[model samples]
Target: MAKIAFILLCHKDPDAIIKQAQSLTAVGDYMSIHFDARANPEHYQKIRDALKDNDHVTFAAKRIKCGWGEWSLVQATLNAVEAAVDAFPRATHFYMLSGDCMAIKSAEYAHELLDRRECDYIESFDYFDSDWIKTGWKEERLIYRHWFNERTQKRRFYWMFEAQKRLGITRDIPEDIEVMIGSQWWCLRRRTIEWILDFVKRRKDVMRFFRTTWIPDETFFQTIVRHLVPAHEIESRTLTFLMFSDYGMPVTFYNDHYDLLLSQDFLFARKISPDATELRRRLGVLYSSDGQRFQISNEGRSLYKFLTEKGRIGRRFASRFWEKESSLGRERELLIIVCKKWHVAKRLLERIRQMTNIPCIEYLFNEDSCPLPDLGGIQSTMGKRHRHRRALMRMLFDYYDTDRLIVCMDPANLDLLEDFGRDRSLTRILEIECHFSDEYLIGHAMRVGLAGDRTPPETIQRLLPTVRNDMTHESDRIRDANFENFLRVREVDPTDVSARAISEFLTVPQDKAHEILSHDHLYAD
Candidate 1:
């Protein structure tokens, strides 16, 4: 059997590392793991002991301190690849995966899929010209120097950073080198892996240049791979499915994503949490990677073609949006929550509770009678249009720097989350639309009052706990047979609060509210 080597870069989660390793490792195949140099020794030893008996398991001789979006991360990956190359000399293909990465298909099927491959699989794209990679995004990170700190801090640099930008003294990226980037995980032909190691040895200057460059791990290897002779030897797709939300965070794999992950055609799904056991069960049967034979059946060939063609671009865009904006601040206190309307928040809150029981996120209900306190009501904003709502939100964030995590709730409010995507200080804007269940949400709303009295909000507040309990435990019963009036806007905003609230929720210009609302009715048509 042709052996495959898996290079896994792991830090904390020991169980996750073992789970993923056991799944991918076959009798003939090998797993080379690189534990972050900073990982707890006790934790690291536990894993080492667990896999020590397995002759195919190898640990990287060189371990490095790895940080997110830093040079260290790439260094760790490179080390793992080199280790795998030495340990599994007979391995035919190399897969770069994280500890959190899991096989979405049977190991046998994955082996069969790669054994028939004619080209290397990796994602490569132009750094500057890619639709997602604009000048504003890369200039400071690429043009200026960024010191790599294991734990990066928000250093408040005033004029000096600006002065450096003006001076533009920098190690120039070679003009011939095309900067390409993609997900960190990839499957490579053994030749490709060797070529990368050789290329790095030859291009020490490129490595040195990337040292001070921001997060060179994302670029250094990517740039070198583009120069590989007969570029057709490479395919610009990583066979890993990482679904990112509009906020640019990976959408956690859940029951809802089963069909999307299955139909979309990818081999591995990445960054799964340790608790995603259900998702692992849903993926399918586990098989011994070593014993699997490379049979080219018609179904297998068709499946391979399907995986090759569909890279899930529509699910996740190339070059994440406002990535720089996401790493700021801690959302400790205060609460800014926005809902499309009252009932929508209730539905989303139910689902969020079901997924992660982190109680930090509070749902904002639309006050049908009066604008609910701190809850964003579309009716509270007078402007019926979108732009008006956007402008209103920016102004609100600027003027009212409330010490609260702003949990925004509507899909139209997605742009508003961009402002805070970089601001870690604010709470994540929990949008209901991104959860993949508008229709289910509508069902939840219908069930919200189905089991209890059909009384209006004024009466529902006292019985809210009972109603919610009924909704959760006795899901089959209808508390209220009538749900049409559940979303009624009882009082009109006599003031222009609706437009202001909508602008804040949507992140558009205040004046453009009229423009957005003008086409609101066309949504149905």
Candidate 2:
């Protein structure tokens, strides 16, 4: 029997936790709970009473008051893990669940899936682009600035700052290093959990940092795991929707419109509604969880049986002219040549055709015009009118099979490339030798190139000329200051010969380079 443990940190919602716990118990899995310190003793007792019949449940020794943006919740979770490990040493897996989390599938099926993958089921939690920080609607500026400054402070504040700075960050850190942002809720293998606990014990500085930061729970596990485990071992896809909000909008959980989450690929989902009557009715046909096996439920079984009985009728109805075989042949190395316009795509194709004879597939996003002229390939046009350029690019790459190699024409394409880089199977190879007339575009290109197979350090260095030149045109002084600060933080000397080479290569005049370089205002914080 596979042993799986569920760890939950609960605050006021004892009833919700109890229901989720009951569902787990019904599925025959062990569970551990940590009531927030703020929960009344009587309420805690009531919660314990609710789960008393389940011999597998255990309570934590430490309780914490959890608030949004505070690290107390994470503290409680860490404390719960120590407790769970002590109580259930034999368990093979530990899943960090929330009071609101619901099991869409059976525990046994989930176990079989994890056992097959041998994966540590956690999202790759790393820093996103610095752009996210500037664009982030969340009121995290004071917290982020304080955390960045806190790095030089006393050990406690330093760790707290590190935790805050790293959490939910997508980009704009040092380019060479890859950072991941993980969900607070995840399932980990026993060995992985043991490794995490041991690593944290040794890293006193990281622990001390956690002391001051709020919501260190999510950052702590993600950062520790990244340091210990290979990037390939971590799952970039999350099983839950913890990141998205639930505003009681008319969203469907199990319908055609809501297919993104319910699609067979995801392992877990977050914040499942307690009142999921509509979801229950709609999903009754697709999934059903027995105590052990999560198989097709009775409703789905009947539907499938009916369809099978209808055989030729169903086949005839399903047959369509547009439904060509979805198979892309034996998984060859696919190079996703991403292009915005037909002429640019043609140029990229010409380059690829000149260098290698391999079959190249092009993904273009122009709605009004079809760029390729009889290339004998599939073409898709995005319907939405607005600048869904980013979203369209994301969807195109998401559809890419991991067996293929992806190469984009532009570096700005790197924004989409990072998402694919997180996937272990996909290989991102960049044709760095090819240069565009617009060097400012190189930063975006380099980002795309980095997302693929590793490019030499010198290649990235060569591209810095384009990056610095583009930096000069920015009207925002604060953004320019931050960009310079990033350079200073990395300790790259502007006076270096290589820096001079980059300054000379820019389209801007030599005087402008000196002017921009000498401008004290650009370096001012």
Candidate 3:
């Protein structure tokens, strides 16, 4: 059983911090908190008392006076790291989070992801001229000296920073190390953290240089880890969601943000307001100790869409993959369908086979939803839990390269099919309606088998009771199907052996055969 240690950097709002600590107990067994030394003693004791009964929570002995964009923040984080590692020596992962952070995914889901991947999750990037983070990666923060500001001297250093930037008097970082920058929030393997601590101790020059730098916390871990290990060993993604507003200030989440926060596949989210009453209630249910599967509910999904459109959330990594996959399968010329009923699917396949020699693949689609839904929106659909099967359709298209059309089995999802159809490149993807009922399909199968040499008429006749009972047990939609949708896509749905031929082959009277063939009610495929 792999465990994780959390180094929680806490500030004001002791109640919020305590609630966050309790929430994290579900995922991380060991938590070492580092409160800002400037935090009021009254509130600090409140936090300590609230979490005193929580065996998982511990506090860092050495608290530092942390400043925004200052080296003290890094030291405070280091203190928490040391405390957490000492407390949980066997822990596999060490994660850094803020007191305002809350988990969104189930502990089981998060643990499974970390355990199976066995890679460090750090969001680091080699610095570029155009890169953002105007503070550290830029030369002014590195080359020029900056004094810590008094609370009264707000915006006092703004001019000095500007003057240095205009002077173009830049000093280059050490040639031996490449500069990197990324989000500070990260989950690293135990060995990665150990390696980092040892690496910094050995490199005194690197350590002293960063001490004078602005907001070194964001760059320190990333630079150290990237320099020591192979790039492939790192998963360069922080599984935490942080919201920013138009002017780049973090939005203080309230009751309205309750659903949007949980929609992300991320394990945690940050910068939540302590006063968000409704959000706290929702979080209590989601992070309850009872240990539910923790799926994103339908409301959460809708809020995700609303926020995404309004630019509240950033595009996810899956969006890039989907962009690349969208252009593929355009050259394919065959159709595939994953159906609800295998028996009905076989009959449909035979009908398609009769229409043309063109190959059609029919897979028995499952009823389960995807554990991790694709950002493609089509996969994580709510109504029918067709998410897994939808993913299967994409995989099959990739494998079969037979992309003429993929008939979605769930007719209620017509709008989604329409959305895909609107894309010119996905013209081959379309909704297909087949009008065969389970009873009719079963009868056709019986007739076909009766005509074949493999099943003698005696065998078919003997199984009459079983066949009738099986047909009777089929659901209303299956038994009452009229086969109207078949004619709509008649080009692909070839006419099977005529009713007259089947009736004669099975020794059924002509008038009864005509009535079965002439049936008009239809069901969507």
Candidate 4:
């Protein structure tokens, strides 16, 4: 296993820092801590006591006070790096975290990813003239002409200005270079750390340039690494939060906002607040702990329970409506319902199929499908509601073809079908009736299949025409007036089998013969 040295830069809030450290320790990873000299001694002692038994942690030689827009922070970070290197020589990577950020993934997974990305993962960028700088010094004019004019704050201002003069703003102002904004917290390969330390030591000119600059902590590493190795070696983006602020202090450490880190394929969520209890419960169903790290669990009891309960409820509801619709002598046919999850499509299809012998096809995006309660009604009036509907529609289109009658359970789903409904040539026909439940669709498909021989042709012909007419009417409404306030409906292609079927049955053209079809050609392919 690859070793990762987690370095926590601490100031105040010892309790939160201790909890964060304990969480990481529980996962079996190396940890080291540096307490800022400005911190209260009592709090520092408490922190030290908390880690008495933890052999991985150590105290640094010197302390530095870090402030916003100050060079002291960079110096403090460099000191921490030197301390970590001295203590953990065998570690492959050095991860800089804050006292507040907690570990969200198992130590094992983090180690594996670090080993894979052998290159430095820090945020680095090249300097350019367009970069924003607070100082007037260009590459040629390093010393500010206004330094002598300032009397009261002369000491501080003069020191900064004279440092910039010695450094010379020419040959690219490294401090002004824009690095991609990312989480300041990072895991960097040992080679990257060694290179940065070496670069800073050899280049006093560059050091002088950064000495007077504001927010040097943010720029120092980015500028140095970019100059040492090209931009590609360093990941332009960080997996940590960059702009997070809590209690008026800019959160510069990873430990501060552990919960907010985005989950990528490489990371598994290890810890969550009880406030996120529901999400934790869901995540737990998919993963288990191996004493050291969390891994995929084979047992799916929770998932099975959810699916069974939902499936049962859906079946019962469909049976109530199936009896009333049976008099129509309509037989169910092969039905395919495509959505983002399989459990929903499965439960619905199973319930309706139990009533009749119709074959059902279900497709889902996520591998671990858990049952969820049906959202009582569509909520597309809100912007978030509409965006979610669009995403589901895109997923559906990407996964399934148009051969099946797509019965969207919610209005958002219905609105998605409306897009294709405009061009009736699509193979997927959408049904948006309130009665269109999973069980209803299943029962309808089964009844149609079972009545294959008994149903009269006149009944079939009459039923088909009625369904087609209803769909055509809805399609007209979707295309004509601006239903944007109610549905935010977008147009879809007529070439789809569902659209084509509805168009042919309604005597509408497969191509754009009508004015409604040509109104918005934006999505036309």
Give the Cα error of residue 245 in candidate 1, in Å: 0.6
Per-residue lDDT of model 2, residues 1-525, tens digit only:
567788887664566667667667565567889987744577788898988888778888788765444566677877888888988877788888766555555565676777777778776544454232222333342234333222112245456556756785432322332434556777888888889889768867566555544345545677677778787788755554433211111111322212333433444555443344455444332333645333332242233335434543333212111222222222223344333223444454444333322224444433335332221123333444123433332222323211222333433344334333332223333222222344324445655463233766677667666655543332123223332111111113443432343233222345443443443332221
Which 10 successive residues of model 1 have the least lDDT summed? 482-491
Best by lDDT: 3
Expressed as tens digits, the lDDT of each residue in 108-163 for candidate 1 is 67767777756777777777777545223475667666673422222223244556
| lDDT preference between candidates 1 and 4, better one | 1
Candidate 3 Cα errors over 4 Å, as ranges: 26-28, 134-137, 150-170, 288-525
List the global CA lDDT of all models.
0.54, 0.49, 0.58, 0.47
- Candidate no. 1 TM-score: 0.55
Q: Comparing 1 and 4 by TM-score, which wins?
A: 1
236-311: candidate 3 lDDT, tens digit per residue? 8788877543223344455666556666667777755455567776775464444555456435435544655555
My TM-score estimates for the predictions, one after another, are 0.55, 0.45, 0.53, 0.43
Segments in model 2 whose C-alpha atoms lie over 4 Å from true places: 128-134, 137-179, 241-264, 277-288, 291-525
Cα displacement (angstroms), candidate 1, residue 293, comes to: 15
The best-first sequence of candidates by TM-score reads 1, 3, 2, 4
Judge candidate 3 at residue 361 and give its lDDT. Answer: 46
With a 3 Å backbone cut-off (N, CA, C), the pairs that clash in candidate 3 are 435-483, 482-521, 484-522
lDDT score, candidate 2, position 325:
25
* Residue 426, model 3: Cα distance from true site in angstroms: 57
- Output the lDDT of residue 500, model 3: 42
